[model samples]
Target: MRKLLVTLVLILTGTAAYLWFEPEDNPDALQTDQELLPDYVAENITRTLYNEEGYRADSVTAVRLEHFELLGFTQFEQPVYTLFNEAFQPSWKASSKYAIWFPQDKIILEQQVVIESLLQNELVERIETDTLEMLFPDNRLQNNQPVYIQGKGFYIEGIGLQADLTEKTLQLVQHQKTVYRNED
Candidate 1:
């Protein structure tokens, strides 16, 4: 009976010492200081912006959004942004697999970016790129990656792109090829 008690006491002491000296396995501790955690996260979020004239200027929809207020940026997954003209009519629709929006009216779209014109009269119907940078209010788009643009009867492929949505102007930095089709 004494040996049994001694054995049980030794086992209990060993367990207590192991527990006290064991390194913490906390997941939070593995995160580094450079890692910027999101302050808020939302799923299936839709955000709208209004112009000074109280007209719908733009709207953004995302499958998942993560906002880092302190970092002054928001990360989005599968984001679609719709831009409206002065008449409150949707003029362009931009979509990407991922995007990062800054507070300075700049948005960086990455991974299979597509910008499509909603206006039937627009000469440029669609633009596709691997990455793009957009400046809102000014409605300017700049991209250094390869760009593919499709118009009414012509299609253009280039290395870089600069576009002004308001002015309806598009210029390719390094034009690779242009093909025109005649319906008639």
Candidate 2:
């Protein structure tokens, strides 16, 4: 009985010493070191932005959105973006399967991006590409991927595109093909 008690005491002392010397896994430190998580998440959200003049500039709707404030970016799934003209009328509409918006007035749209002109009698009615980048304050659309543009009576395919919605100008880096149909 005496030997058993001594051995038990020794085991207890060993356990206590081991526990006291072991490193602690601080939960707070672990969390801080982990990858950044979304600050907020929403479903079926619509948000509109206005210019300094209080005129509507752009609007975006998404099936799902995740905003990472710390990362200064927002991610969207199935997003549709609309750009308004100086008169506060919708001018261009863009849609994509996925998109990322930065606070620096930039948006990157990916996966089957389609930009359509809403203004009447526009030379280009629609533009399609796999990816597109939009820069605000200038209303520019740029991409290095293949692009397809459709107009009233003609359609054009190209390798790259640079368009200015404000100036109503479009330039294709490499023209692939063009087709025209007679309305008559």
Candidate 3:
């Protein structure tokens, strides 16, 4: 009789707890508006990136850099990323007002990003865009914004662009128009 009475008390307490408590649908719900601020910050950062050949392929200088652990990304202000050629000279220059480096070696430069090729290549010398996605190691750049390319006494405007810095190629994906001016 005592054991039966204890079991009944246990059952009643368990049911009462179950009725009063409920688990949250998401205990660690991600807050989209809440940003993981940088725990460590730096100023005037000069970071160099190496290629597969273990050579200094590119370098970036930023006025400020911040790393966000929860967001899993890094932010840069006034960044200048310069790519070097075989001669160790600056071949391409990419600068932006603001930039973010995400996981997997991808970079997004926003706010008036300008990419310039100093190789004296007639293909594409300068490209201006509001934002660009730069996949390092592959030396690839892409954007869906309006692009302006000027080089070799030729100017062109395009809606979208995909460029291979290593191959020295530029393809305007949409709304391409050659805006030529007579030097004569």
Check candidate 1 and list the clashing pairs.
Answer: none
Q: How far is 11's C-alpha from truth in model 3 (Å)?
A: 38
Root-mean-square deviation of every model: 3.8, 3.3, 7.2
TM-score: model 1 vs. ground truth: 0.81
Ten consecutive residues with minimal summed lDDT in candidate 3?
A: 27-36
Off by over 4 Å in 1: 1-35, 182-184
* Residue 54, model 1: Cα distance from true site in angstroms: 0.8
Among these predictions, the greatest TM-score belongs to 2
- 1-184 in candidate 3: lDDT tens per residue? 9999999999999999997896755635545434655868999999997768888899999999999877889999999999998777789999999999998889999999999887775567789999999997888999999998988777888898888888877788886788756742
- Ranking, TM-score, top scorer first: 2, 1, 3
User: Tens digit of lDDT per residue, candidate 2, span 1-184?
Assistant: 9999999999999999999999999987777655378888999999998889898999999999998876789999999999999889999999999999999889999999999999999999999999999998799999999999999999999999999999999999999989888632
lDDT of 2 at 102: 95
lDDT of 2 at 149: 99
Pairs in steric clash, model 2: none
lDDT of 3: 0.87
Q: What is the C-alpha lDDT of each candidate?
A: 0.93, 0.93, 0.87
